[model samples]
Target: MGLPKPLRLKHWQDFQATYQQGKRYRGMYLLLRVLPDPRLNQSRFGIAVSQKVSKKAVVRNRIKRQLRAILLSQRPNLAGGFNVIVVVLPSAVLCKYEHFLRELEQLFKQAGIMNHGH
Candidate 1:
């Protein structure tokens, strides 16, 4: 699943704004930043796999795909109107897909973004 333009953070400034103003959730595999944006009334997502995480473009793309899939699946469960960014750790390149899913889920929960059966 891919995020549409309006539902994705497409600029460096957007990512930087989230990093600056958002709440952070750190995990073993990844980091999450969430910035509230009531104007959208829906959540938008961004995936950032730094070159520090992996030198190869292929590896970075693979990690981005995995993270996008996880976010897309959880999108409906997340709260509205927020910009969420997933930053992969260098260790994440060696981690399994399930690890990414698990860590992201927990991060969302900690960020109070998930519905959590409410």
Candidate 2:
């Protein structure tokens, strides 16, 4: 129904590797870490929403959904051969979707995962 789940990075090891190798960006609502994937043909993503950010399950799920939607919508423009992790910040709950999207786009472009015109 969507971009499918194969593009998501589900393993803890994958998230660890990205943190070890990637470049990070801090936005108003999230921190993004992006690393070049060794495999070179697809993009993978992970999201980290901690209890420190939101103790409630509903809030955390909402954050995840917002992040997932942003990623899926921009998948076609994302650079292949990379792994990304988006760590939710405590301030994320206050951000609107448009602002979140803008922040994400800026970070991705800065990370060289998206072109200037995209």
Candidate 3:
């Protein structure tokens, strides 16, 4: 199963706030924002894909799907109490799923959400 819809950030303010004030890391396919969750015991995520990244809707949706799958697969390792926003870059369209997962794992390590040795 995937993350429930309620766990996703649906408000524009949420994404804007995260982008403006959260700690972030840049990767080959996406930029990741790590922010403390205001809601206790809950984690939220938001995904952004600007028009510049893709002209076709299908491309954007594919990237979002790939990213969501990566996030869901790593949910067990992710710190349980944070809000994470992933901003998809144009380069993401060219990346393979494994590469995306690797970049995400590296970002999680850098954010201290995952251990390097793990």
**lDDT, candidates in the order shown:** 0.87, 0.84, 0.81
Give the number of the best model, judged by lDDT. 1
Tell me how many residue pairs clash in candidate 2: 0
lDDT of 2 by residue, 2-105 (tens): 33677888888888889998898888888999988768677888888999888899988877888789988998888898998988888887777888799999
| Per-residue accuracy of model 1 over 1-118 as CA lDDT, tens digit each | 5887778998889888999999989999899899998798788888889899989999999889888888788878888888998889898989888999888888999988898793
Write candidate 3's Cα lDDT for 22-102 as tens digits: 898998788889888757365678888888898999988888888888887787677666778888888887788898899
Worst 10 residues of 2 by lDDT: 1-10
The TM-score measured for candidate 2 stands at: 0.91
Find the 10 residues in a row with the least total lDDT in model 3.
109-118
List pairs with backbone clashes in candidate 1: none
Q: What is the lDDT of candidate 2?
A: 0.84
Model 1 deviation from native, Cα RMSD in Å: 1.3
Residue 67 in candidate 2 has what lDDT?
79
Model 2 segments beyond 4 Å from truth?
A: 1-3
